[model samples]
Target: MQYFIQRHPLNYDGSQLQSLFTYKNFGLMGDSVLVFRGSCTVEQNEMVDMEDVVAQDWIHSEDMLHFIVEHFDMDLEKTIVRQRLLIATIKEELEVRGVTTLRRSGDDLYAGDKKLSVSIATLSPVSTLVHCGLNISNHNTPIPTIGLTNLNIDDVFQFGESVAEHYCAEVLSMRLARCKVRGVS
Candidate 1:
């Protein structure tokens, strides 16, 4: 698994969660995760989660830290597991940074009652993809939102790097664990 932090700010519009997005856009081949600071406004047409669309829950934030994860294996269940893993990894990182009151409900993370992140996973022909976005600034959000700034996290880039590193390590470790296990006949 490869991890890359995108230095430039890019707007996430729900369309980047596709197969080869990291390879085509950032040149990171194979299973990879790309992190970046950005603005999020998922257009309806680009939305993947049917529940969100049916409920008319718009995904928008003025500023966010986005994690786009892509794996070559196309398994929706596994992809959802990876999505939750990333969320839990973020929660762990937050706790490490002294933010202990975080709560994770499914794929979303919350600081008390205010939402801290949004995420979704889906299949894209050749790959399973996930998009997780953390609020950086509590601005222009549709609902009550809490951001990294509110959590007293000043170094956004460093925080993002730590998250990417830990998530990649966990995923790689899991893969190793699978390989090292002997199947019972």
Candidate 2:
């Protein structure tokens, strides 16, 4: 899957967006200023929950592994190992940074008090993806509508962008190392 992160206005109303804005000022506008859009292809498989409860059609990561090995010519075992290590490191960093309320259950990380959930998975053998969502309800209007909210859109975009840059650097380093070993440019 491919994704994009872009800037928007703090207010949903189109009129609030200024004709000229710097990235720093745009970030100051916060969550309402960023949007993340993506599409993914999911393969389904059955899995048992923590309580041994069976669940159907869970998103399978094997397809992603196959795609990555086929397209990127990376070793599947090495990629999976790196992904596991990266996720564990991220969780530890979050805790060390004082995000003590969040807990990891399998691949899903949750912040119960904040009504936030973040899921991390290997999108491709060599690539990992992070998804974040918030639970919210709008009560000011007569019509009642409830949905998962995006109160930290900017934060999410920044995190994703950082991950992408890091992954690209790692891939480039691997290619360079291989070339050096083979006496190639």
Top lDDT hit = 1
TM-score of each: 0.97, 0.35
lDDT (Cα, tens digit) per residue for candidate 2, span 1-185: 12224433122211112211212343422111123322222322212122222433322111010101111223545545544443444445445445555555544445553323223322333332223222222223222222122222235345534443444455557668887764546
After best superposition, candidate 2 residue 133: deviation in angstroms? 10
Evaluate residue 123 in candidate 1 and report its C-alpha lDDT on the 0 to 100 scale: 88
Q: Give all candidates' CA lDDT scores.
A: 0.92, 0.32
Question: Which digits, one per residue and each the tens of the lDDT, describe model 1 over residues 1-185?
Answer: 99999989999998788889999998999999999998999977998989889998889999999999999996899989999999999999999999999999999999778999989999888999999999999988999999999999898889989999999999999989999988898
Cα error, residue 8 of model 2, in Å, equals 11
Cα displacement (Å) at residue 33, model 2? 23
Question: Would you give me the overall lDDT of model 1?
Answer: 0.92
